[model samples]
Target: MWQFFHKLGSPKWFYGIATRFMPWLLASGLLLLVAGIVWGLAFAPKDYLQGNSYRIIFIHVPAAFLAQSIYIMMAFSAVVTLVWRMKLADVFVKAVAPVGLVFTFLSLFTGAVWGKPTWGTWWVWDARLTSMLILLFLYGGVIALDRAINDEKSAARAVAVLVLVGVVNIPIIKYSVDWWNTLHQPATFKLTEKPSMAVEMWVPLVLAILGLYLLFGWLACLRMKTEILIREQRTRWVRDLVLAGGK
Candidate 1:
């Protein structure tokens, strides 16, 4: 296990391994996303209350899920950096921050779009929405901090501390609906309880979530590989790989 963990910290090893999986991840993710969009938009029954506008959840839910999930992943990477002093850990944080930021923005944007019809307003300061907005700012903070420091080690340590502190906001966002009366509805999907939605309504959502998760992995790997190349540019192995690939 230690050996495996150590290998994961090796940028060269991960880069080589990741290159082999990209094609499969890309193909599967794209296919699942297309299938989910089609099923949710065209075939799923219209909501009795909100009608077709609710279909936006198919996209919003997945993006929101990804937005939240990627932060937890980043937090874990931060821990790895602090405990194990793994260089790859910070690379993961660096590569993932921008992608996570985009997803966070997408979730907020889609939520507002979904809200205009359902809540009769385009914006609100509800707990969940507000917490998510803060989450986006956290991502931006990490990115800004990373860019501000010249020394990579110093920058990484600072970002890791910031990420660790921001993790407290995640559970607040998750449970905000329960903790306070709010315009945003409670979770439609729950682990401890049967989903509030019918099977037809939920199946496509599951697909969208799965597809988005897979795509996130692919995107993270793509970005990490680029970082590896940039960080390892002066190394002989990177030069050799480039030369070999050029032949």
Candidate 2:
């Protein structure tokens, strides 16, 4: 386990693994996403309450899930960066920040779009919504901090500390509906209990959620590979790879 963990810290090893798996990830993720969206939009029974507008959850739930999940993943990487001093960990933090930001923004945008008909408005200050907004800011802060610092190492350390601090918002985002009277509904899916939605309705959502997670993995690998090349440009391995490609 330690050996595998140590190997994961190697940029070259990760790049090679990612290269081999990237195509598979992309293919499977796309397949699942398309399947989920088509099935949900075309075949699944409409909500008796919200009607077709609830179909938007097919996209919104997955994007929202990815937004929060990516942050949690980043927080783990931040810990690894601070504790293990792994350059690859810092590379991951840098590479995935933009992706997280994009997903966070997507979630917020989609939520607003979904809200207009359901909530009778485009925006609200509800706890879940507010915390998610803060989450978006955290992603922006990480990206801004990374760009602001000239020194890579110093910037990584700063970002890691900031990530650890912002992690406190995650649980609040998770439990906001329960902790306070809020406009937001309870989680659409939960691990500890069966979903209240029908199997037909929720299966597509499950596919969507899984597909989005795989898609995030693929995107992270792509970004991390690019980051590794940039960071490792001075190394002999990188030089050899470049020279071979030139040949």
State every prediction's TM-score relative to the real structure. 0.98, 0.98
Q: Which pairs of residues clash in candidate 1, taking residues 3 or more apart in a chain or in different chains?
A: none
Error of 2 at 217 (Å): 0.9
TM-score, prediction 1: 0.98
The segments of candidate 1 whose C-alpha lies over 4 angstroms from its true place after superposition are none
1-247, model 2: which lDDT tens digit per residue?
9999999999888888898999999999999999999999999998999999999999999998888988998999999999999999999989998998998899999999999999999999999999999999999999999999999899999999999999999999999999999898898879889999999999999998888888888999999989989889999888987888821
Instruction: List runs of model 2 lying over 4 Å from the truth.
Output: none
Q: Write the per-residue lDDT of candidate 1 for residues 1-247, one digit (tens) a residue.
A: 9999989989888998888888788889988888888999999999999989999999999998998999999999999999888999999999999999999999999999999999999899989999999999999999999999999999999999999999999999999999988899889897688899989989998888888888988999999999888898999999999989921
Question: How many clashes (backbone N, Cα, C below 3 Å) per candidate?
Answer: 0, 0
